[model samples]
Target: MNKLINRLVLGSALCGFYAGLSNAAVLEVQGEIRPDPSNPGGAQIINNTPVTGYCTEFPGMCGMLNLRSNTFNISFHSSGSIPVGHVIPFGFPATWRTFTVSHSSIPGETAEIQIRIAGVGTRYRLSQKAQEIVGLPIGMDEFYYHTTLWGASWVEATPPCRPATEWGRGADANGTDFTVFWLTPEDVTTCPKSPRYVIPGMSLQRLDVHYELRAVRPEKLIGGNYQGSYTYSMGSDFDMGSLNASDPSMTFNLNLTVKQDVKVEMSADRVYLAPKSGWMEWITHGRKPEKLLGDLRFFILSSSPFKMDLNCERPGIDTCLISNGSHQVPVDIGVSLPSPWVDDTGQPIARRPLKLGGAGLQNIKPAGLPNHLPSLLHFAVPQDSVKDMQSGSSYRGTVYITFDSDI
Candidate 1:
């Protein structure tokens, strides 16, 4: 009985060995490229290894024969509605924007990714009904790769050419191409360990590209909606031996539209008065000479040149006319303009006073106002002037503020 059991065990072991040999040369590679969830304008690559392979069935028995290397390539193509950015007039600042493309390959293989910009050179154009109206220059000079954010850094796939006319691609003045290389691991033990590699059991990689647009003289751009397009292609080059190679190359279109924008708003339509009696008391007692009546909050968001003006119908009659039947007394009015509001690192605007009776109209010409400007309104009556007024009299007038833009 012992001899018979040993024979059966031997037979089973031989059958397993033969099966491993038959499948030793078979390797299945799978993976996909997707957008990285944690980062905007970034991509992730995931590589999936086959479950039934010589390396899994007969690890030590197959030796190096079970070790095979495959190359996977992913190409990036810009699809419809890529991204759009606007250039404000007068060197107004704009934010940086990014677009992403991703690719995945078989696990445990070397990978290559190529980025190519194809179409009417690197110059972006303003189009009308598919007709080019104006052209703006664009190239690798205006583009940057986010290496630190992507975890794995990428080296220039090819040397830059002297007097490079276009971006990544070689001598071609109209087209550009660049490549990045990385390796996919066989398993978690061989995967790249980094904070960006959030998935522990999966082998993934990512890349990000950033871009921006600026207008030195926004006056040149039409003050309406304009459309443009960019053509790009991503091609992957790899070898899969007897298996079909993953075709990771594609062509895409990026549409961009620019719109002229300008806006101005006030915090309140009418400045409400604090109690009239309190104001009269303060003015009569001279308690606070520079007492604040209220603040006129002005908000301006413009991409064009503009000017603001303050006018009063009664500039010559610079008094809040209070009347009880036929009695009236004049109240003094004063306004102070703070420094011109600045957006980010813009130049500072000088402060000026708006004396209703002294000036014809207060003109505020800001080189560029991208933020809020608060003007303080103060009212008072000379101690002597209040003494001549009747006990119960009321006065009222109007102040007009106007904002004009040169688009």
Candidate 2:
């Protein structure tokens, strides 16, 4: 005799629900049963993974479904029309306008879904205008098909370069280094595993994308009338496709949502300073409010708010250098502060101005010192200042130290 056991499996029989309302529930039958007498010991089990299959409702029109039926099968592919225009340079304080695009299914059936955009490109900020944002180029497709409620939908596109100078039939079409997967809050919050895909840069801006649904039967209309059009910049780096379509089967849209560049904002968390004895007043200079490392006006200790600190070197146990009565012993003290800046065109740009105001300790006179022939000040600046900054640029400002002789 054969015996069977039950295993819990839920099959979404969406296809059954669509057929003429004479509904047959998609039932999951599970159990472990002994093999037939001829087969001996092993038992055969009924298993069910998500039932998936494809259907060509009519000639050249295809659809996919969780299960199968004669009249109703579901499937979707990505398609968009881009309006003719130049790709606007993405920048800070710029809002990528919320535009609507239409998508339809074959055979006039309802298809539930979400949307996402991907390609090599850069990301921009929406709060600063005229300031050049820095980032690599990665093209991003929007994700609206997944959201339960289509509030203010938008997908922020990131391309590799701002100038995007090279565009042609033969240019390298790789967008950004990383792949962007647009997910609903459910994708980010409900998933148990950490995302293997990186969003490329630390600062990613959000775009407002809108969606409209249309139902059309391919059998009735010979020519595929695209639902709607989106206005996108004219460039060769653009790649478009259905939300979850296979990679090799990517589709292209003529006019896409407004394509813009990106700006990344950053701030210094801490700073350190190293000053030699007799050197007072470490006059720093740079841009206002934000003293960046590579700004043409980049300098140490610019104006207000961008403050530098003067700290006496931490003395070890019984290691204070004693000074002679007449002449104060000259010693070196270390200085530190939080470093801050933004990335502009892949270059480190100052966000918060580096000031000489905080802690106001430019130079310090040591009470004493061991008679020395040659010596050097050893100190370290906060690593955060260097963390994320571009190369060839100095994050810390230079401080000049001067020692005073008792007059």
Candidate 3:
């Protein structure tokens, strides 16, 4: 905390009400005239009665001067749903005549000033009034308050029958002297879930004061109090900017290898609609999925490019078989599909035709004779190249699946 000085009050004719023999005198102390509640969002402030007890001047050259009148000004919250007000306890000496004096010494200094009310209690009393005025809202923890001063004055001089530098060589004897004081409270930690005090009209909150005393003579001593300000915002959302979104870049690619004689295992990547027993159909109608992966496509290499055939039959002597049609479906380069009619090499009959006991006796084979495989193929399509092929290649193509929809 740094002390800022801009002495501007005009010098008035000194009154000898309780005056000593000094031509000039300087008296100073730090204090704040904080409002009741000291927070805006907690509750409205209706009334506040502050009692300030002055301390005795240090036992230095300026200690001999008698006291005079003092002024007190209270400022209220300025924004939010609650508007602030101002009250001046002017001519306070005439109103509250009990401004007394106590004493305490600076650790290493010979001088000592009287003790006033403790910082916490002074603000606590004001808070009580604020809460009483403002109805306590849910989640609110404190009310708002602020204060200022008027008619502040001081001088520099020697006491009656005493030398100008009576205290010591450092005594004023006409050297520059100045003092400023604030009536504030100690720093108190706020509750975590407590509603913040927003400045009345502004978006700022939690204003703090950092103060220090700068000594041009003797030693540099600095001290001050930090309390909530009613005129400033009391929340953390004061000054902010913008936000951002997450855009992910994903690349999908398919590796197709025409192995000489590869043994590949096939399994369902997704239980899409499950396998149906008889004629069945399905239709999907909804928003396009972000990502979809189909089943694996397995097949063996043929001397010439050709389409694989599909067929199926019930195990045992039931003779139940799929359509007797031999259909051909195109297989892009390097794609593979398993065949059941032939041996492991796709060239030898593993089982004869099943006996249906009817005119369809052309296929009469035992249940699991040698190998009558299932009519399912798994393959991985080159997804990453879809965009590239669509952009760099020209096409005059129409593709179709071997199984057509009955609908």
Candidate 4:
């Protein structure tokens, strides 16, 4: 082993949890990575928001709301249905009416209220935010904004339904919470027009909505909070479905928050470096060593993009140097990361140089590693530099390795 001492520098800028505003509260999600047993790498995005902004706004009518590490589902809002031959007021908006019969009607104050969910392609911004990281890969099959949730229990259907659109197919095929690729935003009614009975005690103006979020691969994203929201315009001239309330539209916002954990552990508590094969080849054969090098093993578990850097103790010394009795020699250092971790060009890190005071390595990202893996730290004194060493000389060095997850 090459004789050397190792030092580790780890850091994290964990963001504070944000509470959702009254009815427009933002959903917050959180997750993390560590050496712990149950959830080592923090590969999944978990819910952190205490409450759903939109769900709280519509207490009893929020059909179902589910928030998990991989699976996301919620009911945003729904609207009342137009009775057959009910007037279709196109250019004008109207308020909901609470027409009541005489209080003489006692026990079963029954009212079968019909409601419908309109087909509206609403776009939303989904993100994983950190101080250094910005923007996320949002797509149909990608982690961020995946296909719209369809074919699930949340989206209950009735009779007299139309064919499903590119995004809401499952709504037409009966109903179940499923997913469909997102497409153009079209304002139309794609759900069954059949009337479903409403509980007798609830307000006639009660509204509802049903939707779900696709699984997000937090392992492939920077560790942080991922918040998302979309507002739907109600009424005959707006989006999603029609709202019978006097208000033109009730803005419903759904937010998704994800928090991720990250960490790095050293396998070799302290480092010791020497010639290859310990000192056997040099001492037994009386041959001088060509170079002095050592490899340090480390376990890395990160759900965020990061960068690496190097520094030396007692700076005014030789820069990247080792000194003994007023003499110092320059040494070299490098890093090698395991699979699923790559550079800017998407290549595995191997012997990447680390200059003492120069810009350190950057753009270190996970290509989707779901587990903690081993990495190597290379410290060496090349042949050119090793030749200057005196016989029976003992040299020691102290260097610091920094793993920054800010990026």
Poorest stretch of ten by lDDT in candidate 4: 12-21
> What stretches of model 1 exceed 4 Å from their correct place?
1-214, 217-262, 272-294, 301-305, 313-351, 355-375, 379-388
Please list the residue runs of candidate 2 whose C-alpha ends up more than 4 Å from where it truly belongs after superposition: 1-307, 311-407
lDDT of 1 by residue, 1-407 (tens): 00000000000000100000012212232333332212322333343433222123333422432232222222112222212221111110112222322211212212123222110001111112111111223333212321221232222211121111222322222222222222222111111112222111111111211112222223222222222222222221111112121233322222212232335444444443333446667657854423223334444433333333434534446434333446444434444434453212343443333343324322233343223446444444445544554543444445444433321
Cα deviation at 324, candidate 4, in Å, is 3.2
Taking all chains together, the TM-score of candidate 1 against the true structure is 0.29
lDDT score, candidate 2, position 180: 21
TM-score of each prediction: 0.29, 0.14, 0.12, 0.49
Superposition error at 158 for model 2 (Å): 19
Best by lDDT: 4
Model 3: per-residue Cα lDDT at residue 60: 38
Model 3 C-alpha lDDT per residue in residues 47-97, reported as the tens digit of each score? 122222221122232234321112122112322332232211110000111
Better of 1 and 3 by lDDT: 1
Model 1 alpha-carbon miss at residue 14, Å: 99
lDDT of 4 by residue, 76-130 (tens): 2324423332222222111211211111122322111111223212112112111
User: Candidate 2 at residue 41, lDDT?
Assistant: 20
lDDT of 2 by residue, 179-279 (tens): 12222221111111111222222222212111121212111111112233323321221222111212222221321111111111112212222222211
State which candidate has the highest TM-score.
4
